[model samples]
Target: MRWFFYFAYICTMETKTSKIFGLRSVIEAINSGETISKVFLQKDLTGAISNELNGLIAQHNISRSYVPIEKLNKLSKNNNHQGVVAEISPIEFADLDAIISTSVEKDKAPLFLLLDGVSDVRNFGAIIRTAECAGVDAIVISKHGSAPVNADAIKTSAGAAFKIPICKVDHIKDALFQFQAAEIQTVAATEKTDNLIYTIDLKIPTAIIMGSEERGVNPSVLKMVNAKAKLPLLGEIESLNVSVACGAFLYEATRQRL
Candidate 1:
Protein backbone atom coordinates (compact mmCIF):
# COMPACT_ATOMS: atom_id res chain seq x y z
CA MET A 1 0.00 0.00 0.00
CA ARG A 2 1.13 3.49 -0.81
CA TRP A 3 0.89 6.18 1.84
CA PHE A 4 0.98 9.81 0.76
CA PHE A 5 2.23 12.43 3.12
CA TYR A 6 0.15 15.61 3.27
CA PHE A 7 0.55 17.36 6.62
CA ALA A 8 0.08 21.20 7.93
CA TYR A 9 -1.84 25.80 10.08
CA ILE A 10 -3.93 28.79 10.81
CA CYS A 11 -3.47 32.55 11.11
CA THR A 12 -3.30 32.96 14.88
CA MET A 13 -1.64 31.49 17.98
CA GLU A 14 -4.43 29.50 19.56
CA THR A 15 -2.06 27.20 21.46
CA LYS A 16 -5.21 25.09 22.06
CA THR A 17 -8.85 25.48 23.01
CA SER A 18 -7.67 27.87 25.70
CA LYS A 19 -10.88 29.80 25.79
CA ILE A 20 -12.71 32.49 27.72
CA PHE A 21 -16.35 31.92 28.50
CA GLY A 22 -19.19 34.40 29.09
CA LEU A 23 -20.05 37.44 27.01
CA ARG A 24 -18.57 39.98 29.39
CA SER A 25 -15.50 37.84 29.87
CA VAL A 26 -14.86 37.60 26.15
CA ILE A 27 -15.20 41.35 25.88
CA GLU A 28 -12.62 41.76 28.59
CA ALA A 29 -10.21 39.38 26.90
CA ILE A 30 -10.41 41.38 23.71
CA ASN A 31 -9.89 44.70 25.46
CA SER A 32 -6.91 43.27 27.27
CA GLY A 33 -5.14 42.63 23.92
CA GLU A 34 -5.27 38.89 24.32
CA THR A 35 -4.73 37.24 20.96
CA ILE A 36 -8.13 35.69 20.21
CA SER A 37 -8.35 33.20 17.37
CA LYS A 38 -12.09 33.47 17.20
CA VAL A 39 -15.23 34.25 19.13
CA PHE A 40 -18.34 32.13 18.99
CA LEU A 41 -21.56 33.95 19.74
CA GLN A 42 -25.01 32.55 20.17
CA LYS A 43 -27.15 33.23 17.15
CA ASP A 44 -29.50 36.18 17.58
CA LEU A 45 -28.13 36.79 21.01
CA THR A 46 -28.97 40.36 21.90
CA GLY A 47 -28.07 42.38 24.94
CA ALA A 48 -25.92 45.31 26.06
CA ILE A 49 -23.05 42.88 26.48
CA SER A 50 -23.61 41.55 22.95
CA ASN A 51 -23.36 45.06 21.59
CA GLU A 52 -20.11 45.58 23.38
CA LEU A 53 -18.76 42.28 22.07
CA ASN A 54 -19.73 43.19 18.51
CA GLY A 55 -18.04 46.54 18.83
CA LEU A 56 -14.91 44.91 20.16
CA ILE A 57 -14.91 42.41 17.33
CA ALA A 58 -15.14 45.18 14.79
CA GLN A 59 -12.55 47.33 16.50
CA HIS A 60 -10.05 44.50 16.61
CA ASN A 61 -10.96 42.97 13.24
CA ILE A 62 -11.54 39.64 14.94
CA SER A 63 -13.34 36.77 13.25
CA ARG A 64 -16.68 35.98 14.87
CA SER A 65 -19.27 33.37 14.08
CA TYR A 66 -22.85 33.29 15.24
CA VAL A 67 -23.14 29.65 16.12
CA PRO A 68 -25.94 27.65 17.71
CA ILE A 69 -26.01 27.44 21.49
CA GLU A 70 -25.25 23.75 21.16
CA LYS A 71 -21.95 24.58 19.50
CA LEU A 72 -21.10 26.93 22.31
CA ASN A 73 -22.13 24.29 24.80
CA LYS A 74 -19.72 21.79 23.25
CA LEU A 75 -16.94 24.35 23.14
CA SER A 76 -17.55 25.51 26.70
CA LYS A 77 -18.33 22.13 28.19
CA ASN A 78 -21.70 23.48 29.39
CA ASN A 79 -19.89 26.13 31.34
CA ASN A 80 -21.54 29.49 31.80
CA HIS A 81 -20.64 30.63 28.34
CA GLN A 82 -23.25 33.40 28.60
CA GLY A 83 -23.78 32.96 24.86
CA VAL A 84 -20.14 33.73 24.06
CA VAL A 85 -16.81 31.92 24.02
CA ALA A 86 -13.46 33.21 22.89
CA GLU A 87 -10.50 31.08 21.88
CA ILE A 88 -7.38 32.74 23.26
CA SER A 89 -4.11 32.56 21.42
CA PRO A 90 -1.09 31.97 23.58
CA ILE A 91 1.32 33.94 21.35
CA GLU A 92 0.91 37.30 19.70
CA PHE A 93 1.23 37.59 15.94
CA ALA A 94 3.91 39.78 14.38
CA ASP A 95 3.53 42.28 11.58
CA LEU A 96 4.64 40.95 8.20
CA ASP A 97 5.91 44.34 7.15
CA ALA A 98 8.01 44.65 10.27
CA ILE A 99 9.46 41.20 9.77
CA ILE A 100 10.23 41.96 6.13
CA SER A 101 11.85 45.31 6.89
CA THR A 102 13.97 43.79 9.61
CA SER A 103 14.94 40.87 7.44
CA VAL A 104 16.07 43.16 4.65
CA GLU A 105 18.55 44.65 7.09
CA LYS A 106 19.97 41.27 7.98
CA ASP A 107 22.99 39.57 6.37
CA LYS A 108 21.30 36.26 5.52
CA ALA A 109 19.04 36.33 2.46
CA PRO A 110 15.97 35.82 4.70
CA LEU A 111 13.85 32.75 4.09
CA PHE A 112 10.13 32.72 4.82
CA LEU A 113 7.33 30.11 4.82
CA LEU A 114 3.83 30.95 3.65
CA LEU A 115 1.08 28.38 4.21
CA ASP A 116 -1.72 28.65 1.66
CA GLY A 117 -4.28 26.76 3.74
CA VAL A 118 -2.65 23.92 5.64
CA SER A 119 -5.18 22.56 8.19
CA ASP A 120 -3.75 20.03 10.62
CA VAL A 121 -2.47 21.04 14.02
CA ARG A 122 0.02 18.18 14.14
CA ASN A 123 1.37 19.09 10.73
CA PHE A 124 1.43 22.73 11.64
CA GLY A 125 3.35 22.03 14.80
CA ALA A 126 5.90 19.87 13.04
CA ILE A 127 6.34 22.51 10.36
CA ILE A 128 7.00 25.18 12.95
CA ARG A 129 9.58 23.07 14.71
CA THR A 130 11.31 22.22 11.46
CA ALA A 131 11.19 25.79 10.20
CA GLU A 132 12.83 27.15 13.32
CA CYS A 133 15.45 24.45 13.25
CA ALA A 134 16.17 25.23 9.60
CA GLY A 135 16.52 28.98 10.27
CA VAL A 136 13.25 30.11 8.70
CA ASP A 137 12.65 33.76 9.52
CA ALA A 138 8.87 33.69 9.77
CA ILE A 139 5.71 31.81 8.79
CA VAL A 140 2.58 33.36 7.31
CA ILE A 141 -0.95 31.95 7.19
CA SER A 142 -4.38 33.06 6.11
CA LYS A 143 -7.01 34.10 8.64
CA HIS A 144 -9.86 31.86 7.50
CA GLY A 145 -10.39 28.14 6.84
CA SER A 146 -7.04 27.08 8.30
CA ALA A 147 -6.78 24.80 11.30
CA PRO A 148 -6.56 26.23 14.77
CA VAL A 149 -3.20 26.19 16.54
CA ASN A 150 -4.31 24.01 19.41
CA ALA A 151 -2.31 22.48 22.26
CA ASP A 152 -1.38 19.51 20.11
CA ALA A 153 0.34 21.79 17.64
CA ILE A 154 2.12 23.63 20.43
CA LYS A 155 3.34 20.38 21.89
CA THR A 156 4.36 19.09 18.46
CA SER A 157 6.35 22.22 17.79
CA ALA A 158 8.13 21.71 21.07
CA GLY A 159 7.39 25.33 21.89
CA ALA A 160 8.83 26.51 18.57
CA ALA A 161 5.50 28.28 18.09
CA PHE A 162 6.68 30.68 20.80
CA LYS A 163 10.06 31.09 19.17
CA ILE A 164 8.90 31.90 15.64
CA PRO A 165 7.23 35.06 14.42
CA ILE A 166 3.96 34.05 12.73
CA CYS A 167 1.94 36.52 10.65
CA LYS A 168 -1.77 36.31 10.01
CA VAL A 169 -3.23 37.93 6.90
CA ASP A 170 -6.66 38.27 5.35
CA HIS A 171 -5.50 36.57 2.17
CA ILE A 172 -2.44 34.66 1.01
CA LYS A 173 -2.16 37.08 -1.89
CA ASP A 174 -1.50 39.95 0.48
CA ALA A 175 1.67 38.39 1.79
CA LEU A 176 2.68 37.31 -1.72
CA PHE A 177 2.42 40.88 -3.02
CA GLN A 178 4.28 42.24 -0.03
CA PHE A 179 7.20 39.90 -0.64
CA GLN A 180 7.25 40.77 -4.34
CA ALA A 181 7.23 44.46 -3.49
CA ALA A 182 10.26 43.93 -1.33
CA GLU A 183 11.94 42.26 -4.33
CA ILE A 184 11.78 38.89 -2.62
CA GLN A 185 10.98 35.95 -4.85
CA THR A 186 8.10 33.56 -4.07
CA VAL A 187 8.38 29.87 -4.96
CA ALA A 188 5.24 27.80 -4.68
CA ALA A 189 5.62 24.15 -3.77
CA THR A 190 3.41 22.21 -6.13
CA GLU A 191 3.30 19.26 -8.54
CA LYS A 192 1.66 21.29 -11.29
CA THR A 193 4.90 22.01 -13.07
CA ASP A 194 7.85 20.26 -14.62
CA ASN A 195 10.20 22.39 -12.54
CA LEU A 196 12.12 20.73 -9.75
CA ILE A 197 13.09 22.53 -6.56
CA TYR A 198 16.63 21.30 -6.96
CA THR A 199 17.13 23.75 -9.81
CA ILE A 200 15.73 26.72 -7.97
CA ASP A 201 18.23 29.02 -6.30
CA LEU A 202 17.34 29.08 -2.62
CA LYS A 203 20.21 31.44 -1.78
CA ILE A 204 18.24 34.52 -2.70
CA PRO A 205 15.72 36.22 -0.46
CA THR A 206 12.84 33.79 -0.92
CA ALA A 207 9.41 32.93 0.41
CA ILE A 208 8.37 29.31 -0.03
CA ILE A 209 4.62 28.78 -0.32
CA MET A 210 3.01 25.50 0.72
CA GLY A 211 -0.63 24.84 0.00
CA SER A 212 -3.48 23.12 1.83
CA GLU A 213 -3.32 19.46 2.77
CA GLU A 214 -6.27 18.53 0.56
CA ARG A 215 -5.23 20.47 -2.53
CA GLY A 216 -1.84 21.80 -3.43
CA VAL A 217 -1.50 25.54 -4.00
CA ASN A 218 -4.66 27.27 -5.03
CA PRO A 219 -4.86 27.82 -8.77
CA SER A 220 -5.23 31.56 -8.23
CA VAL A 221 -2.17 31.70 -6.01
CA LEU A 222 -0.05 29.61 -8.34
CA LYS A 223 -0.66 32.20 -11.04
CA MET A 224 0.78 34.91 -8.79
CA VAL A 225 4.08 33.36 -7.81
CA ASN A 226 7.56 33.79 -9.27
CA ALA A 227 7.97 30.05 -9.72
CA LYS A 228 6.50 26.66 -8.87
CA ALA A 229 8.53 23.56 -8.05
CA LYS A 230 8.19 20.16 -6.42
CA LEU A 231 10.21 17.43 -4.75
CA PRO A 232 10.81 14.26 -6.68
CA LEU A 233 8.73 11.13 -6.19
CA LEU A 234 10.26 7.98 -7.60
CA GLY A 235 7.71 5.48 -6.33
CA GLU A 236 3.98 5.02 -6.72
CA ILE A 237 3.30 7.04 -3.58
CA GLU A 238 2.11 10.37 -4.88
CA SER A 239 2.76 12.87 -2.11
CA LEU A 240 4.53 13.70 1.11
CA ASN A 241 2.91 14.78 4.35
CA VAL A 242 2.53 18.53 4.50
CA SER A 243 4.90 18.80 7.45
CA VAL A 244 7.36 16.36 5.93
CA ALA A 245 7.30 18.23 2.64
CA CYS A 246 7.76 21.47 4.50
CA GLY A 247 10.73 20.06 6.32
CA ALA A 248 12.23 18.84 3.06
CA PHE A 249 11.79 22.20 1.41
CA LEU A 250 13.23 24.06 4.41
CA TYR A 251 16.21 21.77 4.76
CA GLU A 252 16.91 22.06 1.06
CA ALA A 253 17.20 25.78 1.48
CA THR A 254 19.40 25.22 4.47
CA ARG A 255 21.56 22.84 2.51
CA GLN A 256 22.03 25.31 -0.34
CA ARG A 257 22.84 28.13 2.02
CA LEU A 258 25.40 26.12 3.90
Candidate 2:
Protein backbone atom coordinates (compact mmCIF):
# COMPACT_ATOMS: atom_id res chain seq x y z
CA MET A 1 0.00 0.00 0.00
CA ARG A 2 1.33 3.41 -0.96
CA TRP A 3 1.10 6.16 1.67
CA PHE A 4 0.88 9.79 0.67
CA PHE A 5 2.82 12.45 2.57
CA TYR A 6 0.98 15.76 2.19
CA PHE A 7 3.17 18.14 4.13
CA ALA A 8 3.93 21.78 3.34
CA TYR A 9 7.31 22.84 2.04
CA ILE A 10 10.08 22.76 4.65
CA CYS A 11 13.51 24.31 4.15
CA THR A 12 16.72 22.61 5.19
CA MET A 13 19.22 23.58 7.88
CA GLU A 14 22.01 23.67 5.29
CA THR A 15 21.66 25.66 2.10
CA LYS A 16 23.28 22.93 0.06
CA THR A 17 21.61 19.51 -0.06
CA SER A 18 21.37 16.80 -2.68
CA LYS A 19 17.87 16.62 -4.17
CA ILE A 20 17.18 12.89 -4.47
CA PHE A 21 14.45 11.74 -6.83
CA GLY A 22 13.71 8.51 -8.73
CA LEU A 23 14.49 4.98 -7.51
CA ARG A 24 18.16 4.94 -8.41
CA SER A 25 18.94 8.25 -6.67
CA VAL A 26 17.06 7.18 -3.56
CA ILE A 27 18.78 3.79 -3.56
CA GLU A 28 22.15 5.50 -3.80
CA ALA A 29 21.32 7.86 -0.94
CA ILE A 30 20.27 4.95 1.24
CA ASN A 31 23.38 2.96 0.38
CA SER A 32 25.64 5.95 1.09
CA GLY A 33 24.20 6.40 4.62
CA GLU A 34 22.21 9.56 3.93
CA THR A 35 19.76 10.52 6.66
CA ILE A 36 16.37 10.01 4.96
CA SER A 37 13.29 10.97 6.89
CA LYS A 38 10.92 9.03 4.65
CA VAL A 39 10.38 7.80 1.11
CA PHE A 40 7.29 8.27 -1.07
CA LEU A 41 6.75 5.73 -3.80
CA GLN A 42 3.94 5.61 -6.33
CA LYS A 43 1.33 3.08 -5.33
CA ASP A 44 1.64 -0.42 -6.85
CA LEU A 45 5.08 0.30 -8.25
CA THR A 46 6.46 -3.21 -8.51
CA GLY A 47 9.51 -4.38 -10.41
CA ALA A 48 13.21 -5.11 -9.82
CA ILE A 49 13.68 -1.49 -8.63
CA SER A 50 10.86 -1.73 -6.11
CA ASN A 51 12.22 -5.03 -4.88
CA GLU A 52 15.66 -3.48 -4.37
CA LEU A 53 14.07 -0.55 -2.52
CA ASN A 54 12.16 -2.92 -0.27
CA GLY A 55 15.34 -4.86 0.48
CA LEU A 56 17.19 -1.66 1.42
CA ILE A 57 14.29 -0.50 3.56
CA ALA A 58 14.41 -3.76 5.49
CA GLN A 59 18.17 -3.60 5.86
CA HIS A 60 18.29 0.04 6.99
CA ASN A 61 14.91 0.31 8.72
CA ILE A 62 13.96 3.31 6.58
CA SER A 63 10.46 4.82 6.69
CA ARG A 64 8.52 4.46 3.42
CA SER A 65 5.11 5.20 1.95
CA TYR A 66 3.21 4.02 -1.14
CA VAL A 67 1.01 6.67 -2.68
CA PRO A 68 -0.63 7.78 -5.91
CA ILE A 69 1.47 9.05 -8.81
CA GLU A 70 -0.07 12.50 -8.36
CA LYS A 71 1.23 12.55 -4.80
CA LEU A 72 4.68 11.59 -5.99
CA ASN A 73 4.48 14.28 -8.65
CA LYS A 74 3.60 16.91 -6.06
CA LEU A 75 6.46 15.77 -3.82
CA SER A 76 8.93 15.91 -6.69
CA LYS A 77 7.51 19.19 -7.96
CA ASN A 78 6.68 17.55 -11.31
CA ASN A 79 10.21 16.26 -11.80
CA ASN A 80 10.77 12.83 -13.29
CA HIS A 81 10.55 11.09 -9.92
CA GLN A 82 10.45 7.54 -11.39
CA GLY A 83 7.90 6.51 -8.74
CA VAL A 84 10.10 7.43 -5.73
CA VAL A 85 11.30 10.44 -3.83
CA ALA A 86 13.30 10.51 -0.59
CA GLU A 87 13.27 13.37 1.89
CA ILE A 88 16.69 13.73 3.48
CA SER A 89 16.94 14.60 7.17
CA PRO A 90 19.74 16.72 8.48
CA ILE A 91 20.01 14.82 11.79
CA GLU A 92 20.43 11.08 12.11
CA PHE A 93 17.95 9.41 14.44
CA ALA A 94 19.41 7.93 17.63
CA ASP A 95 18.75 4.39 18.80
CA LEU A 96 16.79 4.12 22.06
CA ASP A 97 19.02 1.39 23.54
CA ALA A 98 22.13 3.42 22.81
CA ILE A 99 20.60 6.50 24.38
CA ILE A 100 19.78 4.63 27.58
CA SER A 101 23.23 3.06 27.70
CA THR A 102 24.99 6.38 27.19
CA SER A 103 23.11 7.92 30.10
CA VAL A 104 24.04 4.95 32.27
CA GLU A 105 27.65 5.16 31.22
CA LYS A 106 27.79 8.79 32.32
CA ASP A 107 26.13 7.88 35.65
CA LYS A 108 23.33 10.30 34.80
CA ALA A 109 19.61 9.91 35.00
CA PRO A 110 17.79 9.88 31.66
CA LEU A 111 15.00 12.33 30.92
CA PHE A 112 12.89 11.42 27.90
CA LEU A 113 9.79 13.04 26.32
CA LEU A 114 7.16 10.84 24.69
CA LEU A 115 4.39 12.35 22.58
CA ASP A 116 1.18 10.33 22.52
CA GLY A 117 -0.54 11.94 19.50
CA VAL A 118 0.99 15.29 18.71
CA SER A 119 0.43 15.56 14.94
CA ASP A 120 0.77 19.30 14.58
CA VAL A 121 4.09 20.02 12.98
CA ARG A 122 4.65 23.35 14.73
CA ASN A 123 3.76 21.95 18.12
CA PHE A 124 6.01 18.94 17.61
CA GLY A 125 8.85 21.23 16.56
CA ALA A 126 8.38 23.49 19.57
CA ILE A 127 8.44 20.53 21.90
CA ILE A 128 11.64 19.29 20.29
CA ARG A 129 13.26 22.71 20.65
CA THR A 130 12.24 22.97 24.29
CA ALA A 131 13.26 19.39 25.07
CA GLU A 132 16.74 20.06 23.70
CA CYS A 133 17.07 23.23 25.77
CA ALA A 134 15.80 21.46 28.89
CA GLY A 135 18.44 18.73 28.51
CA VAL A 136 16.12 15.92 27.66
CA ASP A 137 17.95 12.66 26.85
CA ALA A 138 15.57 11.72 24.03
CA ILE A 139 12.15 12.41 22.49
CA VAL A 140 10.06 9.36 21.62
CA ILE A 141 6.88 9.22 19.55
CA SER A 142 4.89 6.42 17.98
CA LYS A 143 5.32 6.29 14.22
CA HIS A 144 1.63 5.91 13.50
CA GLY A 145 0.03 9.09 14.91
CA SER A 146 2.88 11.55 15.16
CA ALA A 147 3.73 14.42 12.84
CA PRO A 148 6.19 13.85 10.02
CA VAL A 149 9.63 15.38 10.57
CA ASN A 150 9.27 17.79 7.68
CA ALA A 151 10.88 21.15 6.91
CA ASP A 152 8.34 23.15 8.89
CA ALA A 153 8.99 21.09 12.02
CA ILE A 154 12.72 21.45 11.62
CA LYS A 155 12.46 25.19 11.01
CA THR A 156 10.07 25.73 13.91
CA SER A 157 12.40 23.78 16.16
CA ALA A 158 15.07 26.33 15.31
CA GLY A 159 17.17 23.32 14.30
CA ALA A 160 17.00 21.79 17.78
CA ALA A 161 15.60 18.67 16.11
CA PHE A 162 19.13 18.11 14.90
CA LYS A 163 20.58 18.38 18.41
CA ILE A 164 18.53 15.68 20.14
CA PRO A 165 17.58 12.07 19.53
CA ILE A 166 14.03 11.58 18.18
CA CYS A 167 13.20 7.90 18.54
CA LYS A 168 10.20 6.65 16.55
CA VAL A 169 8.85 3.50 18.13
CA ASP A 170 6.41 0.85 16.98
CA HIS A 171 4.20 1.42 19.99
CA ILE A 172 4.24 3.88 22.89
CA LYS A 173 2.99 1.29 25.38
CA ASP A 174 5.82 -1.12 24.62
CA ALA A 175 8.38 1.63 25.03
CA LEU A 176 6.82 2.55 28.37
CA PHE A 177 7.25 -1.05 29.43
CA GLN A 178 10.92 -0.94 28.53
CA PHE A 179 11.39 2.19 30.60
CA GLN A 180 9.64 0.56 33.54
CA ALA A 181 11.84 -2.54 33.35
CA ALA A 182 14.85 -0.27 33.23
CA GLU A 183 13.62 1.30 36.50
CA ILE A 184 12.73 4.58 34.84
CA GLN A 185 9.52 6.27 35.94
CA THR A 186 6.99 7.45 33.35
CA VAL A 187 4.95 10.52 34.29
CA ALA A 188 1.86 11.74 32.48
CA ALA A 189 1.25 15.49 32.37
CA THR A 190 -2.49 16.12 32.37
CA GLU A 191 -5.05 18.50 33.86
CA LYS A 192 -7.09 15.58 35.24
CA THR A 193 -4.47 15.08 37.95
CA ASP A 194 -4.45 16.90 41.25
CA ASN A 195 -0.83 16.06 41.95
CA LEU A 196 1.36 19.04 41.18
CA ILE A 197 4.29 18.83 38.77
CA TYR A 198 6.65 20.43 41.31
CA THR A 199 6.01 17.66 43.83
CA ILE A 200 7.26 14.83 41.65
CA ASP A 201 10.83 13.60 42.29
CA LEU A 202 11.85 14.02 38.69
CA LYS A 203 15.51 13.89 39.69
CA ILE A 204 15.35 10.16 39.04
CA PRO A 205 15.50 8.71 35.54
CA THR A 206 12.15 9.53 33.95
CA ALA A 207 10.06 9.73 30.78
CA ILE A 208 7.35 12.38 30.58
CA ILE A 209 4.35 11.78 28.32
CA MET A 210 2.77 14.90 26.77
CA GLY A 211 -0.36 14.60 24.68
CA SER A 212 -2.23 16.82 22.26
CA GLU A 213 -3.73 20.03 23.62
CA GLU A 214 -7.21 18.99 22.56
CA ARG A 215 -7.24 15.55 24.30
CA GLY A 216 -4.53 15.80 26.95
CA VAL A 217 -3.05 12.35 27.76
CA ASN A 218 -4.67 9.15 26.60
CA PRO A 219 -6.49 7.42 29.47
CA SER A 220 -4.70 4.13 28.88
CA VAL A 221 -1.34 5.85 28.93
CA LEU A 222 -2.34 7.77 32.04
CA LYS A 223 -3.05 4.53 33.86
CA MET A 224 0.33 3.12 32.93
CA VAL A 225 2.48 6.06 34.05
CA ASN A 226 4.18 6.11 37.43
CA ALA A 227 2.53 9.42 38.30
CA LYS A 228 0.07 11.98 36.95
CA ALA A 229 0.86 15.67 37.33
CA LYS A 230 -0.63 19.04 36.36
CA LEU A 231 0.34 22.68 36.52
CA PRO A 232 -2.11 24.76 38.52
CA LEU A 233 -3.96 26.76 35.90
CA LEU A 234 -5.69 29.50 37.88
CA GLY A 235 -6.84 31.66 35.00
CA GLU A 236 -9.69 32.24 32.58
CA ILE A 237 -7.92 30.19 29.93
CA GLU A 238 -8.81 26.57 30.56
CA SER A 239 -5.44 25.24 29.42
CA LEU A 240 -2.13 26.04 27.87
CA ASN A 241 -1.13 25.04 24.36
CA VAL A 242 0.54 21.63 24.29
CA SER A 243 3.88 23.16 23.37
CA VAL A 244 3.72 25.66 26.24
CA ALA A 245 2.52 23.00 28.64
CA CYS A 246 5.31 20.66 27.57
CA GLY A 247 7.91 23.36 28.14
CA ALA A 248 6.54 23.98 31.61
CA PHE A 249 6.53 20.28 32.47
CA LEU A 250 10.08 19.74 31.19
CA TYR A 251 11.47 22.74 33.06
CA GLU A 252 10.01 21.58 36.34
CA ALA A 253 11.88 18.32 35.85
CA THR A 254 14.99 20.35 35.12
CA ARG A 255 14.49 22.25 38.36
CA GLN A 256 14.17 19.04 40.33
CA ARG A 257 17.25 17.57 38.70
CA LEU A 258 19.30 20.66 39.42
Q: What are the models' TM-scores?
A: 0.87, 0.79
Task: Give candidate 2 regions above 4 Å deviation.
Answer: 1-19, 105-108, 212-220, 233-239
Model 1, range 1-258, lDDT digits (tens) per residue? Answer: 111211223323332458889977888888888888878889999988799889999888887789999999999999999999887777888999999999999989999999998888888989999999999999999877666665667767877898999999989999999999999999999999999899999999999999999998999999999999999999999999999998889989999999
Best by TM-score: 1
Residue 227 CA error for candidate 2 (Å)? Answer: 1.9
Q: Would you list the C-alpha lDDT of every candidate in the order shown?
A: 0.88, 0.84
Question: In model 1, which regions exceed 4 Å deviation?
Answer: 1-17, 43-48
- lDDT of model 1, residue 15: 29
**Whole-model lDDT for model 1 versus the true structure?**
0.88
Estimate the TM-score for candidate 2.
0.79
Alpha-carbon error at 242 in model 1, in Å? 0.8
